[model samples]
Target: MRGHLPNAARIIDGFHVVKHANEAVDKASKAEAGENPPLKRTKYLWPGNESNLTDPRPEVRRDPAKRRSKTARACGMRERLQDIHADSANRTEAEAGSKALRSWMMHSRPEPMKALAGQFRRHRQDILAYFDRPYTNAILEGLNSIIQHAKTRSRGFRNMDHSGTMIYLTCGELGLNTVTA
Candidate 1:
């Protein structure tokens, strides 16, 4: 990107980074579940913000800090990274947070998280660039999701023209003045 678009701010979306971190945590949980009984059926509890955790059991919610499994540790680390992203208002703060997270993950026990640490090292600049230019492809992703839903609802449109029209109709916000002026 730097070769062609010299002036472009190459940013790595924080959302994607956190997503991969959650995936890594999930992978860690799966691997650890074999040796650890507590983690056996808790696969669904690993992914998502630490605050909005989805586990229905009240005991599970209160006892996370007591659990010392790799999965729990990985979840904590992922949450820390998410918090860093949320709190960082400038590149300096983000870089500092990234450095701390990278070091912690690099030394952490989970293999998947260690791999994620390597990723952070390689894409440090791109990740920090997000703080420099806070922009995300969320709108595009949402539009694409809407279009996909529209396509699914249509269940294979008759032709390309119809597909295109369906996508536009699903995604576009058209103003219809029904009342006569």
Candidate 2:
């Protein structure tokens, strides 16, 4: 289903992918925080006590420190996952996801996904046209990652310009050679 281009791709897959990522993130978050609905580590379920996290996998216990509230953490994770999706990003994620969107664009040109080919046959030209593009949106994603990391380390920006300047400069440093407004 994901082996097609922008046109043939179904919108549902995007939601599914993001939803799975969120589940993973949420499960890990709760497991760490010891919050509502205690989560068991499947192969190694941890008891409420520290001594319970015993097993071959090296006693792993995550402490969800007060960096943010549980709800805040969940929201942030969801946002990040959503950011990887284009339809939700206004082509923002397309910069990275659209370009580096695997599973769909990976396969082959000829005998492409039959279902997808049939669906976007009319739009094939535009879909295949992606090759002509000089760069992929992956770069934007890289820039976003840098920005996220910077914010994490610096502990949020003072304001919009402050954050924007930092992100812009970071993009430049990372070789976003051509800056578009």
Candidate 3:
């Protein structure tokens, strides 16, 4: 989305959100010349919601326009990346806004699914950012892929919250929110 919908105010990727965080972390491994830290290691690397997350992901989390080492000029679509930063450098405030979302969920008094909740918050921007932009795309087709995949890979919902979270998170990824995803 950072590439395809850079100008778009709100580009909701209900399906891509989940993969991006993990991808960020994965991408960080190859970025050695940048200031942004790589994907977070360990589940609880970030402290409770206070402010100023020391987690390495923050630097990796900043907007591309903010990247100090960005050397990409007004180039055409990039198919492959040279460094881990290629993701962050091309990212938007919406995609970068996951820091706040993750913070909110991590500190939830009753901590829903700290892990998955963090995942949702981490990608909140990419999911909700669609509303900010003029163009709104459909992601339900992709979300269906997740639902079908989940059902085949795992058993039925263990609990309603987990089930709801899975559905909501998937909706956010697929850009489908029947009930305010």
Most TM-score-accurate candidate: 1
**TM per model?**
0.81, 0.26, 0.22
Error of 3 at 41 (Å): 36
Ordered by lDDT, highest first, the candidates read 1, 2, 3
Model 2: how far is 38 from its true place, Å? 35
Worst 10 residues of 1 by lDDT: 172-181
**Segments in model 1 whose C-alpha atoms lie over 4 Å from true places:** 1-6, 54-66, 152-159, 174-181
Please provide the root mean square deviation of candidate 1 (C-alpha atoms, Å).
3.8
With candidate 1 superimposed using the best TM-score fit, by how many Å does residue 119's alpha carbon deviate from the native? 1.0
How do the residues 1-181 of candidate 2 rate in per-residue lDDT, one tens digit apiece? Answer: 5555644422234434444444544544454445533333322332122333455422233434332334234334344435554344344434454344333323422122222324334443343344333234555567778988766665565787766666666656745455556
lDDT of each: 0.82, 0.43, 0.40
lDDT of 1: 0.82
Question: Higher lDDT: candidate 2 or 3?
Answer: 2
In model 2, where do residues sit more than 4 Å from their true spots? 1-114, 119-122, 131-135, 172-181
